[model samples]
Target: MMSGEVVHTFGFTVYFVFALMFTWASHIQRTNPGAGWWALSISSAFFARLLYFALLYTGDTRLIITAYAFFIVLEKPLMLTGIVRFLNLPITTRWFWFIAALADLWLAIAWVGEFDGFTRIAGYSLINTSLLACAAWLIFRHHKVVPGLSLRIAALACLALAAHWLTAPVFIQLYPAWATTGFAVGTMLTLVQYLSLLTAVLSLFQKRLLESEARALDMAFLDPLTGLNNQRYMTTLFDQALLLATRPHHIVAIFYIDLDNFKPVNDKAGHAVGDEVLKAMAQRLKDCTRSTDICARVGGDEFVVIGTQFTREFQVEEMARKLLEHVLLPIEVGGYTFQLGASIGVSLYPEHGNSLTELVQCADKAMYHIKRNGKSGVAVYGGETAGGLGLREA
Candidate 1:
């Protein structure tokens, strides 16, 4: 509805605004793969439009027109490449760059050789539409796997932009009044595309936020060094297992494990090597314990294994032997082989104590009894220290 000059000026303003906004956004997310490319594409497109209006107002120059046409044709491919990178898809660098270069060359030749206005328009429309169509195909093909509504909308926006460019030449040829209204229509279409792109950007930020929160939650419950459950996580499982132990014929076994002569390894080799020993031991403990059992690293050189569903008394002893055998195996760390040993003290539900704290204290006392007699051994909680194998008076 505005005059041609006003429409053209406002159109330039819109492009400049989006260009600046995307540029700022790209800097904020500079680490992201496709952000920089998309920013450059948007700014280049804005530059092309600015030059087009400048040439029309002043004396027309074929070279300047060619440069503007080059950027206009270049925009879609840049955007498509950026989208592909954003989606983590493989890029065929050779074929894509070759085709883009050849298209630009053709446009340059056409403009310098004095091609008619309709010929130039057709050339740009065909190339730009084809590029947008390719982008749409890529988005649609991957949409189901990613399953984002914003991505779907982005693909539809690409299709709509392609359709607009494809029909532009025909509309100009058929309708004599198209020249008057063409700028307004082009500006509106550009606005729609810009808004769609903005939506996709917001969607990406939301996805990143969700991923960060999940990582934080996982870190809360897991030990980063040993990749095992922490003391807090073990306590939660212990409480749950305690409630289940109230049923008939159910017994919960707690093993308080300590690494024997472990400080010597840290003194001989640096803490880095000692860390490797701990990781290797953690893996071995996980392998020795049954799937129903929960193994946790509760201290620097202390671990715990809680097992439920103990049908036989011998099963716990058998597991303790396996734990000792695995931990005794020599581990290679930082090109040095070191022998490791473990002392475990086991306490059972109802037999040792009813509560988790009582069971742990019982197990700890039994463990210290083993440590006092010898470094590496397993002992069960007996009636009392005076009465049996390894236990304190009740």
Candidate 2:
């Protein structure tokens, strides 16, 4: 075979590979019909391109190129849709594909030689330009929602296809061989794009798995009702906090928060409603906390919040103030609102205790003092006096 034939032959073969791959992918998506639709649509478009090229390079006839130009153009937008749908990226509809198909049919059939060549060029240019503009719009709209890797790879592929389509007129002049060479390069480009998509898909799956595992771990160590770390987990957290606190410039605060009037909800509305109220309260506590803070439920209506990266005592106090307010507010559920409040006691590192047990004991004592002082407040453990421990308002 001539070199040109070789160039064109593999070009057709590459398209065939894409066609079969898309078809097989769709077929195997028996459980996922949505994905199957996407695959079939993409495969059809690739099949069209393959058939067009298959005829052109083998027979060396204007008939194939002339007859299939519209088919080729029509396939472009469908190609995009396939990728978008495959990635589960959002799209409104097939409007772009419809418009492209119409434009392609008109251009392929209507263009005459010489006199109309410029118009043909302009026609295809406008249509292809619209396709590119649409692709860009899709990318921009989804940039924030799409993952970084997926965005980079998909966007590059779209832009490449657009470039290839737009340069049709000029490519003929630069090197009459440019088209054949582009075919070979394009095959490699397709392979790279496929690999990238595969990477993105794998990343997505791995991300989901990590999230699931994290949730499972959380459930194992978290009190779902109060959204606080369970006793075992909180103890571990306390030890970790203490270790972190030993470092220079690292300060940690341990707080034991006890709810006031919590038993009333369980008594009046029953445990089910009480459970709902508890869940709501826990969510509020979570909302009030920073990401680095560890909040845990150590007992019934008893919770703890550990603050890391704390440098000053005031930070702990401010946090207590926020927590107090968070728990004091009325929670509304099922058209009924209920008022509840919490008492909090804080103990700082080095001062409260050198050990986790000492710190927790000190904070617990301070919490009792707050309860005795009539609740809805914060108390901090002061230094030990000659007789006993000291509790101060925070």
Candidate 3:
């Protein structure tokens, strides 16, 4: 069997390594308060163990022992605080002070009563057990919100550490010969807890990084003013839809919409009101199209709608009519009511051209046909133009 001195040396060495690792992590993740608190917790544990080990060689003095006890009691509260802060949980300052006071009172009672080493160990174990259990409970409760395998593993390690501490006193009382073995087991459990927590922290960092990247991609591809897909993204969608439309009967309709009298809204009502009018128009375009369709704001007063999986020409014509009707609806923004109209030109796949550039050009020509004949109408490529029922000014 190994001596108590050997076990203490090994445990303190492990604590020292973990403390350095946590300190480095805290520095790297300076924004995370939980990581800083965790560093402090491990550092406190290392200090307590180092002081105890030093006293073994030097004479054990009351002041030194009290300092060691103070650090030992301080470690668990710091760990609990780290867990609470890391998970972004709400905790009262008063509760933190209350826990710290309770721990201090227990340490004082043990010191003043001149408790034996075994009694001190048992009392401190119970307190540490309660704290570890609380930490485990908090992690488990929030596991769903912050999902990761590492988090669950960390919670389980905390629970196991709590159970080890809770049972240590009983095992030590019944089998004094196995006291060193109990200490060894505790050191192993502490090691597991530390590693698991480190992994959990890394997992959370990775999650944040992935979410940030996704948001960045959205900002790059989305239109800032209308919250619609931009021209570049729309082109990408058009290519993908072309690949899916392999059947000879499948028709993809590209509608190129040019707003009538939109510039006057910007000039008369101010750009702010014109922006609101554009947003309302974009929403109407979205409502008229199916989920499979792609709608985008391609220019200042121009939009594109791509409809896929259409088996007949009339379906495309019907969709074009719906879009023009919806765009012609009255828009009320900032207490000012405005009526707008649209001239939409449509071109079909295979008949117009294979590529997006070809289809858009064909659609644009068809739209100009409507503008020349009369405003507010839908025109089909290689076909006749339908004029608006009622034409209105800006």
Provide the overall lDDT of each model, using Cα atoms, as 2-decimal numbers: 0.77, 0.68, 0.81
What's the distance in Å from true for residue 119, model 2? 8.4
| Candidate no. 2 TM-score | 0.57
Clashes of each: 0, 1, 0
Off by over 4 Å in 1: 1-24, 27-33, 36-81, 84-120, 130-156, 177-196, 267-273, 311-314, 330-339, 350-358, 382-394
lDDT of 1: 0.77
Q: Which ranges in model 3 have alpha carbons more than 4 Å from their true place?
A: 1-6, 28-31, 59-68, 93-113, 383-394
lDDT of 3 by residue, 1-394 (tens): 8887798799889988888877787787444677788888888878887787788666664555566667866888888888888888887535654675776787689788987766766776777788788878988888764566766777888899899878877887789878679778877877887887887777777777898898998888888889899998998899888865788799999999999989889988999999999999999999888888899999998999999989998988889888988988888898888888888988989887989998998898888878887879988888433752222111
Which pairs of residues collide in model 3? none
Number of the top-ranking candidate, with TM-score as the measure? 3
- Best-performing candidate as measured by lDDT: 3
The best-first sequence of candidates by lDDT reads: 3, 1, 2
TM-score of every model versus the real structure: 0.70, 0.57, 0.85
Worst lDDT 10-window in candidate 3: 385-394
Comparing candidate 1 with candidate 3, which one achieves the higher lDDT? 3
| Ranking of all predicted structures according to TM-score, beginning with the best and ending with the worst | 3, 1, 2
